[model samples]
Target: MRQKVFNWGRYPQGDVDLLPLYYLEELDELTSKPCIARGNGRCYGDSSLSSQVISTITFDKALIFDKKQGIFKCQSGMQLSDILDIIVPHGWFLPVTPGTKFITVGGAVASDIHGKNHHTEGSFSKHIIEFEIYSGEGLHYTCSAKEHPDLFHATCGGMGLTGIITSVTFQLKKIESVFITRVQEKARNLDEAFELFEKYSNHTYSMAWIDCLKGGNSFGRSIMMAGEHTTLNELNAKQKPEALKLLQGSKLNIPLDLPSFMLSGLSVKSFNELYYHKILGKVKQDKTYFDQFFYPLDAINNWNRMYGKHGFIQYQFVLPLSTSRAGLVEIMEKIRNQGSGSFLAVLKQFGPQDGMLSFPMEGYTLALDFPFRPGLLKFLNKLDELVLKYHGRLYLTKDARMDAEVFKASYPNLGEFINVLDKYVPKRSFSSFQSERLFG
Candidate 1:
């Protein structure tokens, strides 16, 4: 059936033919066409989009669980939320999870997602044991670190270009409680934020929310949050029962598209100022549920609608530690001058790079959300220039308007990634609109 499909950002929508796969046998028929596999539509951009899109949601299933060993083998289409619901109560948790649990295992593998604990745990692909994948050429392979290792590495972060993942096997981390002993510290400026990150690097998890609207001495004012998993013994009797729960609260939904003016510079500045002080008023240390700490925004259903009908762009980039401060300040200054306010700006530190095309590196990463406007595209193009100048790169999972030249410049390994794709999937049958735009 023909339908409109878009990534999580809700920008650059496309009309495509949605092919639903209920059985593995159906892949043989889809091999004749150019297509890409899509799962839960959680990727922020066009990486999962194609004229002929294959929907994998029907393949969702939990195939096996090794309770004692903490290993989970499941179909690629299974959502992270489903896995958490089944394993959290069993004292097991995801080794690494992105900000949201609404994504699919295949999507996570394709993006090679990183989390707050990336300084120590690495990306999602680190925990993967093996996975079954198929090229559009009717070839199926079981890939792992020790078996078909080349295909395994390429497929993990190849963004659905290598092939369509069928099933995955990975290990899970054991947790004593679902609550996190989260600590918050308000950084006076960008420098202090960096210091706090280093000061708390010993923690299991760390992330910062920065105020992008402010400049001068107040530039990069943020609240750094560091968290560690709580132990069962630490929780009192009243908190014990709730510690095992996953999502314990209600959700609010944006029923319709909001007016574009709702997110203007004035409104955003006001919100950021209030939010910064709100966190300042909170206790330095407190206990919170895992869901609340990790996926607070998920509680708002269809939250993208708040950006209005024109949608928004989620710009995320990483710069080496040596140049992060200067590069980040320049970009923030450009945004402030443009009168574009990113209320949801997030800053975090990333460890060494792992996957062949993994987004993270040994440096700092910042993510921002900007509602679309008449001159927004041009403004982002300028930001790309700054990113390239600082030896930084953009995240494909959150990009929509980046061109081929910028993509090549940012990802230095583009040639290697392309060679691997051509060597295995010669026909390049597994392709997405993004694949054509950036690598075709």
Candidate 2:
């Protein structure tokens, strides 16, 4: 089928020939075409976009499950949300998950997504035991940390450049309950927020929502939150049932695309103030369901539409711990000075850069959602310089408009990644808009 496809960000829209791959034999047939695997289309940018896109949604199926060992082998298209629905009730959880559960298992591995818990648990690639990939040569190979380690590392965070992931076998963390004990801390400014994060580094998960509009003494003021999975014993007997209940999919949705002006500076400022006060008023929240703690935005379906038809860009970057504070403060100040409003400005600490092209490092990562507008690219380019100055790199999964030069500078392991690609990928057999843009 031929159709238009835009990423979750809704920017850089384009038409593509969507090829559906159902059986394994189809992989051989696809070898003659220029293509890239497409999962749930949750990626924020063009990483999954291609003129000849391979739709993997139909390939979703759980092939194997070992409840005792907390191991699962499933087809690539199975979504994290679906997996969570099945595993949470069984006391097993994904080792790492991004903010939303809408992404597929293959997408998670391809992007090597990290979560609020990355400071301790690392990214999704850490838990993957092995996976099967259909490479550009039209051959299937099993890649793991031990077996075909080169291809394994490359494929984990390779962003579908190496090949189409067929199936994945990964380890799942065991959980006693579906509840999480959350703690909220109100930071007067960015400095305090960083201090609080360091003080609470031992927590299982941590994140902050900063008010980027503020300046001087109030610059980077935020509400920091931390969470730990609550054991069954930690929950009151009466609350156990509610906490253990499996989460349902979101039915609440934005019926229409909001006008771009709806997110104007004044409006966003008002909302930020209210949110800051709301979180500040609550010092702690206990016995929250796992879904509530990790995927709050998922409650509102099609939330991206709020950014309007032109769409938005989610710019997420990480800096080394040594330069993170200064780098972030400078970037936040720049945004404030530019008079741009990013209603969603998130901050989290990452442990270390593990995967070959992983976005994280031992530092602080900040994410800002900016609605697309005139001069937006210029503005992002400026931010790119700031990130590069501090030796930071943007997250490829969320990027929409980063220049190839900026990308090359950000990810130093690009050579290694490309070397692996060269060895496995045949000419014009596997490609994406992003790969072509960044390394074409």
Alpha-carbon TM-score of each model against the true structure = 0.98, 0.97
User: Where does model 1 exceed 4 Å of error?
Assistant: 281-283
Model 2 ranges with Cα > 4 A deviation:
241-243, 280-282, 426-428
Please provide, for model 1 over 123-238, each residue's C-alpha lDDT reduced to its tens digit, 9 standing for 90 to 100: 98899999999976678999998998888888888899888899999999999999899999999899999999998999999999999989889899999999999998899999
lDDT of 2 by residue, 115-225 (tens): 999999999899999999999665889999999898999988788988899999999998888888889989989989999899889998999998999887888888898
Q: CA lDDT, every prediction?
A: 0.89, 0.88
Question: What's the CA RMSD for each of the models?
Answer: 1.2, 1.3
Task: Give the CA lDDT, 0 to 100, for residue 279 in model 2.
Answer: 58
Native-to-model Cα distance after best TM-score fit, residue 406 in candidate 2, in Å: 0.9
| lDDT of predicted model 1 | 0.89
